[model samples]
Target chain A: MAVKAGGFKRRSGASSDIPSSSMADIAFLLLIFFMVTTVFRREKKREIDWVSAEATRKIDEKRKNILHLWIDNVGQVWINDQAIADEDIARVVRPIYAQNREIVIAVRGDRDVPYSKINTITKQLQAAGAVRVTFATRLEQRLQRPRR
Target chain B: MPILSRKQRVSDEIPTASMADIAFLLLVFFLTTTVFNEEKGLPIVLPEEKEEQEVSAKNILFLIVQPDGSVTVRRGESEQEQIVAYRQVEGILRQELAANENLIAAIKTDPSAAYRHMINVLDEVKKAGAERISLQMVGE
Candidate 1:
């Protein structure tokens, strides 16, 4: 009887490992969720080359109030990644102007492009009757060197 | 019977000792593949064409841009137009701007000029705290 009691105690005390085989599956599922939701925002930043400016105010307006136009380093004009000719800028801008009278046409050009391309774009915007057109510039140090 | 039970239990466990390693490998793969947001630009409005009144050259500052990225600033109150470097425009315009708050800097950029230089001049003009700016494209 004593021996049987001891055997029963030892049997009850035996340790068993917790199951963790599903850990890889859980982690893989989470990784897939993140991968699908990840957005690089590639349209604006790729090859932009924004020129740095000083004492420039922020773009205070809401995203809905502005139309973003980007010019690549190679002089290719794009609106939301759609290629549009310089001459057709007005056609694209006109209707948006009609819908929202307070719309601002913001021109973002690459630092390496020529002024001629910018001129053509702005002129087209004007012809499209866009009253508010602005150039986009990156920020730089505001304080100047002290006077001698 | 004992041997068969032992073999069955070992096969049922699924060999999960390497599970943590596989999870870490997948996590690392995702971490390396993430994309982050970048910086945006500061917006400024161009002057209205309908409000284009004929102001004499003496009333405005002219920043002439050449194809080689050189800048020439013409002051509002003075008739003299001097070829200035990009760095000098900021201090020069700032002093002149302090004296007169209503000064306007007109950018007469040659179409052949590099676009980066025009933006540089615009930056300096804004740096000087001038409120009114006009851009006119010159030379096709």
Candidate 2:
């Protein structure tokens, strides 16, 4: 019986440690899954000169709640990658406001654009019943502030 | 010769003990380095359409921006206008706001004025911590 017990000890030589061979495969699978599921934003970047401000703040609203309205230096307005006429702004934005009541219009106007163009856009936004607005600007450092 | 034959019989599997550590290191590096492009701006709420409220003229502070980028400050119910550089607007508005808590900063920009000129004045007014702000266009 003692000889059989000694022989059984040889049969019980299975590894007590957890197998690590598949760990790399699991991590690689997660990495590939994240890479596949990630959606990249592909908005075309407009090259308008950004206005800088000392009072610039980060808009804390969610990405979905904010809408980008770009006004180029020539006073041309662009929304959602489409060039929109000044007269048609309210019409275009009304439906979007209807779809999402919490939509905040982010006016990314060029610094050289006339104030009248911005005024007109604000009026159109008011007509569309979307009141919350943000003027997107770069943060200006106080050291480089131009003295009048 | 027997040892050389035994060496040839060894297992041919590649070792992967540290693969998880290497992958996790890469993941941590990417996670720390990835920067999201966040939205930034000066936030303001516009009044609803046709929702004009009658504010007393004494409670209004006019900041008239010209096409030349100069600012003309005018108090409500006063004919006197003070022309100052855009940089001094914050100091002027801060003093006025201290005396009158219900003061409204009415920024009237010329139609032909560059947008930055208006924004400069607006930034100063906002810096002064004015709660009631009205944006208007000249000759509108």
Q: For candidate 2, what is the interface RMSD? A: 2.6
Clashing pairs in 2: none
| Candidates' C-alpha lDDT | 0.75, 0.90
Off by over 4 Å in 1: A1-45, A141-148, B1-39, B76-79
Superposition TM-score, candidate 2 onto the true structure = 0.82
Note the DockQ of each predicted structure: 0.35, 0.49
Per-residue lDDT tens digits of candidate 1, residues B60-125? Answer: 777787777778777756777688788788788777677766667777898878777888888777
Interface RMSD of each: 4.2, 2.6
Candidate 1 residue A125 C-alpha distance from true site, Å: 1.2
Please give the lDDT score at residue B130 for candidate 2.
94
Per-residue lDDT tens digits of candidate 1, residues A118-147?
888887887777867667776667467653
Q: Which candidate achieves the best TM-score against the true structure? A: 2
**lDDT tens readout by residue for model 2, B76-114:** 899999999999999999999999999999999999999
TM-score of each: 0.67, 0.82
